[model samples]
Target: MAELHEQLQQLWSTANKSFRNVAAYGKRNGVKLSPSTVKGWLGGVVPDSTTALTALVEYLETAAERESGWQRLPGGEWAALYRAAHEAKVKARQKTSAPATTPQRASSAPTLQNSTSPAQPGDIEKARRILKAFPLDASWFTSFEHQASFHRIHDSVQDPLYDGQNVLARNYKVRFLDPDLQRQSEKFHDTVNAFLHSLDHMDADGKSGYSQIPTEWRRSFRDQYESLLRKLSGQRDELMTEYGALINLFNERGIPLLPNGS
Candidate 1:
């Protein structure tokens, strides 16, 4: 079976760009992927989070060498590969951690390591630790990796973010977490839209409207651009607080998706 890192290396080799270029592509596409993260993926680290894997795969699709006729695998095939690789890594970890006892004792060992349970405050703390393993910044609202970090914590504690009636939000496309998550996500997309609109408008307008527009009218454009450029410390703090609320709410409601792991 091909490991994910090995497959990533093969894909990287087939692409025309270097790791830094790939990282830059990720940033443009709203993922906070770094060159070091790409290097780590090539160095045998199983991308426990799918966001990084998706970023790399999508990057390769855009960066493929057309002259050489290179093409990435189909989306379905990529999904299969990711599932296989993740399963293989999980199995390997389980095998290595297995006790050296007799067959009977080994069989008696618990198999519910991933069982669901309400996320305790301790689980929240542990999730915070896991979040530390990934990069974070003011741009986290646009970074799917930041969203994935919360999923990791939720998965580890066996908490499902979905409401019972709405399973579609948990899918690859929407990825709905907290209501705040959705709100912030929409806000980020709006900001991106505004930036694009301003870019196109400025390019078309040029100096034609330079002296015609009032001071506030010109500053309105500047304000929109500045909003896009300004630091998002408030948003970041809000997200952090929302994460904590998710855990606390689930814990109080006693509605975890599964029993606590042994």
Candidate 2:
């Protein structure tokens, strides 16, 4: 059995729950995690599988709610936290099981591979692209509009794309079971999600803030919008480059998935 990850241990500690408590919950669900599994998690071993993660998170959340007057974590937040932690675990496994394939960068580099390299760094790109055969024009859904209609592109365009980003990220993580590309998909998903969330707080017509603004605030709004737009474009382009590279790899291997990514 592996040690419990330190953060997992701390979360459990803060909940005042015992390791035995988690095992009990798993036992009820017929999963039956052991005492050493808790140790393993603390000792930096990730959960054996999603099943174990779900069980641990369930126990943690249940205990946390009970300790905090029984207020359950919001379902969405709960899932997000679990997913983020699970991904971190996936990242850790990738590190130990493999090796650093690219020179580590300063603040902004990928935890796995650098995205901005003129070419994909290593064999990971080959594996990353093989999971999906992108449609030539299929990126329409993922593409950001340079010229904004601004009426409700937030609703019609950005939001849907944000949702799609999440779906694609999950498919990479769970379906293809590729953590590296899963991280890239997650980067795109998070940037889109952040952009979407920002839309709710803005005083303008849409995300671009150019809809019908007062002249005084219009300059600042436009500045903010441009900044946001540049990021959106960059993130979108990176993913597209990846998709294009993936397609190239597929062609090289003579095992192209259908253009529709089927």
Candidate 3:
């Protein structure tokens, strides 16, 4: 575990200082992470939630791949080392997070009888009433709106490609080349897929279609989608906000935003 921690720390260190800024960006999204927090995690102070770990991993991966051209390092050594270290860290964290077990069961316990009893008239009537009240139409409409909203955002983001003429062709070309924009495009794709899947099972009962879902199901989905939308909005804003900061850094070192080879 300690060796894994060391490897993770080294991996984090290899990326440029932009990593710190990215960490700060993640913190703004409610991650509460600093570069030091990443250091601590790599040193075996596991993050309390998988969400934190996931955010850290995603930021690091994106930063590293951005810096390293998305190519595997020579001999695939860096990726191999990172994978092993990450697996170990995950296992250790899971062990730490699992609930403690009790040594013994309580003495007083009820036994079940095998005899089957038919449903009472009142119970059958209650179930029928409940099923009659299930919100299938509402679920279907909400799902449709969710899918449509995602598609609209997807199409709007691709508007840059049209450049006033060949919109579809231009958008495709730009997305193929622009990593930042591509990530947003992929996220929109995934959200749309998830929304579709949710709709398929939305009204299912006991894992079947038409089952009553928890009251919070739609609310939770809405919350998570909203959070992701906000993050995407932030990332887009940062392209502008950090442009000056990045330009200044490059200018101080006599480097142009576009290198000579490109």
Per-residue alpha-carbon lDDT of candidate 2 for residues 237-259, written as tens digits (9 for 90 to 100): 55556555555543454444465
RMSD list, candidates in order: 15.7, 15.2, 25.7
Q: In model 3, which regions exceed 4 Å deviation?
A: 1-3, 70-262
Per-residue lDDT over 150-207 for candidate 3, one digit per residue giving the tens place of the 0 to 100 score? 2112222221211211221112222212222223333432342233223222122222
Q: What is the C-alpha lDDT of each candidate?
A: 0.42, 0.48, 0.39
Clash total of candidate 1: 1
Candidate 2's C-alpha runs over 4 A off are 1-97, 100-134, 139-164, 171-217
* Per-model TM against the reference: 0.37, 0.37, 0.26
TM-score sort, best first = 1, 2, 3
- In candidate 3, position 45 carries an lDDT of 40
The local lDDT score (0 to 100) that residue 133 gets in candidate 2 is 29
Candidate 1 local accuracy as lDDT? Answer: 0.42
